[model samples]
Target: MSTQSERIKERRKELGLTQQQVADPVGVSRVSITQWENDPSVRISGANLARLAKVLKVSTNYILNGGPSRMEEPSGQYHLENNLAAAPAMHGQVPVISWVQAGAFTEVCHVELDPEDTIWLPRPPGASEDCFALRVVGDSMVPRYNPGTLIFVDPEVQPENGDDVVARLTDSSIEEATFKRLILEPGAPKTLMAINPNWPHRFIEINGNCEIIGTVIADMNLRRR
Candidate 1:
């Protein structure tokens, strides 16, 4: 008898779907699909199981039992997975705010100012629902991060030495936020450094005038056509 893992792998291949393609609509990492296909003992949660069923065009009972023979389907109606109403719920939503609005966003934390511009993202482990995203605006961090790159920020993550971070100038006179690599050494003052050496203002001393807003966890680059 075929195991659940074998059934999942066979069905996925039969439908010509890659693991990443399935993971995207389901709001999970591709690693999750790999594990599910290799380990029969790995239990998929109810929500993800339902999502897998829909994407695979099979019934949850067939997935759990390893074949259609284990469970009978109704005479006229199709499987529940075929119904649009049965789609899996989104993992979470991250607000994509402008660079100028980033400063005030970190201050308020959870307030939803605009909903239409938000992006759905799979919540990372230990990341809070308050996490947000920002689009790179300048070439300050060129070579590593280019303009129009989308970066996800987690305010709860502790900014460590050499970590990329979004910082705000605490000087009330400057309302703009900046993105750079943070440098923190024992007994030495903190500073922000840009990746591009050609940028005029490369180093910024974070004396009492700057505040670290959040640590950058992940980024996506959308190539222009």
Candidate 2:
């Protein structure tokens, strides 16, 4: 019997759908779809698995234990083999907010958004329902992260050593949030390090006045997308 990952890949190809197409409606990144199709150790949650079955136009049972596609047909559907139209994409969207708005992120992660004020993008897998996105605006993180890169932020994840984070200095007058790699050293204060060595403020110590809004879960260069 074919494994679930193989079955997912097989059905995806049989339908001639790109991973991104499948990912969008499934509320995950294209990278996540790739991982699901290739990584045997990666387990698909029940909700996602059901969504995958719908997106792939197959039954969950077929994905779990392949034999024949027993997927339920749409009402008033034709019975022509391999002639089904693509299923409509269905996925949750994450709101993209401004840097200034990100600074206002409280412990509850409450964001008051007007539908017109924010752009919505697909929510990547593992991100909280309240996850948000920001566009990179400076050269501080340059070498690896360029301007115009879109980053997904999840407030639920704890910031750890070397994690990229969005933070605001509560004591400063600046209202915009900042993004940097967090650094933690034994017997030393936590610090945020800018990836670009040439940047003027390359390293800033995380003092009591500093508030980390959220850790960056994923980032993509919009120019390349």
Candidate 3:
């Protein structure tokens, strides 16, 4: 049986791509590529798998199973890993938390308190359980997320430094969450970021330490006009 590394190397050679060329495109080291091609013990992440899929011009499932799954991207929209129509947490179930700004702030807004304070939606089949959601308010995350927009987050997943994420900072007033991409800064970790280049992504790094809410999962957005 061919190992994942061998398969990766074989595929790369078949495409006439040098290790350096591939590394430059993916922002990883050529040695890392070498290791990936040779090490059978290396387990990759979904994001890395996505990058490989694009580089190989194949589907993610193809890399995993040597073939593609029935899942297909919708005609007009991006296919989220999970569906948003699943039943949300009910009474005594997961409680829905309040909204918090990913950018720096003094106090967390506390209003419209509800019984379901920690309720989160269910994960789709074959999806991870770290998923959660937060409602959007300001235009800081506009274009990608609108006011009142419910954003799904998955903490089990780690986004690249610049990837979008939902950060949960201490509100003191209430436990709240905010979503944004990263500025790709060094050291201090921040969450709030922008998904669209048109929208400026701003993130607030903790002076000491705070919780990273979660990585964005699926989203239920209103149809654009």
Candidate 4:
């Protein structure tokens, strides 16, 4: 019988899904998956471990006990080994890395974070490393984050019932990123709404098509308090 990790790797390949594909569904990373299969030092949450078991066509007990089992268990649907990583922020200030593509798969480009892009007020320590800062180049996200202002994106933060979020609209031609309010329609369709009365409240229908970069932890330069 295949070992626990071996079984996971085998099942993943059988599904024809990339490491990333599997990782997203399970809220992890492809890199982590690779490490999990190779290192015993890695561990996953019980919930995630169960999900993995389901994907691998194995019982949770099978993984925990590694008891007598068949090596050729059936395969199923697709699957962060991050153990020692820490936040990269500074004292009295947060170090915003740079905005990353939380939605579409665009060409990877490097960004040299500009000091002006950061704001040092009412933010958690090491919060800078939690998000990427993007310069607002247009008015799509006006009345909140204006042009030339910097918005921070934390992909790990979940957008709340109606919190503003950094999202990637399905239409690539639109602004590279937009900050919008999340609107969950339950039975209807998931979408984002623009509250700026000047601009139409755009509804970005979400399904398997759209991507959410992250929730906006803090807004920059809306107005002076």
Q: Cα RMSD (Å) per model?
A: 12.2, 11.7, 16.4, 14.9
lDDT of 2: 0.77
| Tens digit per residue, CA lDDT, model 1, 1-225 | 888889989878866688876776565678888999999998775445655666676766677786453333235423223333311323433556666777765575243342222444455455555567788988999989888888888887899999999988877676667899999999988989998999997998878887777899888876652
- Poorest 10 consecutive residues by lDDT, candidate 2: 79-88
| Candidate number with the higher lDDT (3 or 4) | 4
Q: Give the TM-score of candidate 2.
A: 0.59
The candidate that achieves the highest lDDT relative to the unseen native structure: 2
Clashes of 3: 13
| Ranking of candidates on lDDT, top first | 2, 1, 4, 3
At residue 11, what lDDT does model 4 achieve? 56
TM-scores, all candidates, are: 0.57, 0.59, 0.39, 0.44
If both were scored by TM-score, which would come out higher, candidate 2 or candidate 3?
A: 2
lDDT of each: 0.71, 0.77, 0.53, 0.55
- The RMSD (Cα, Å) of candidate 1 is 12.2
lDDT of 4 by residue, 1-225 (tens): 556677667656776766665555344456778887777656654334544554455555565457755245434543223452322213222333333433331333223222233332333444433345555655656677677676666666877778778777665675455667888756878877876656665776777766777777665655542
- Which lDDT tens digits does candidate 3 get at residues 81-197? 333232321210112345543322223222222211233344433334323356676777778777877766555676666666766555444455556675556765544555545
Clashes by residue pair, model 4: 22-79, 23-79, 29-80, 32-80, 32-81, 95-128, 98-132, 99-132
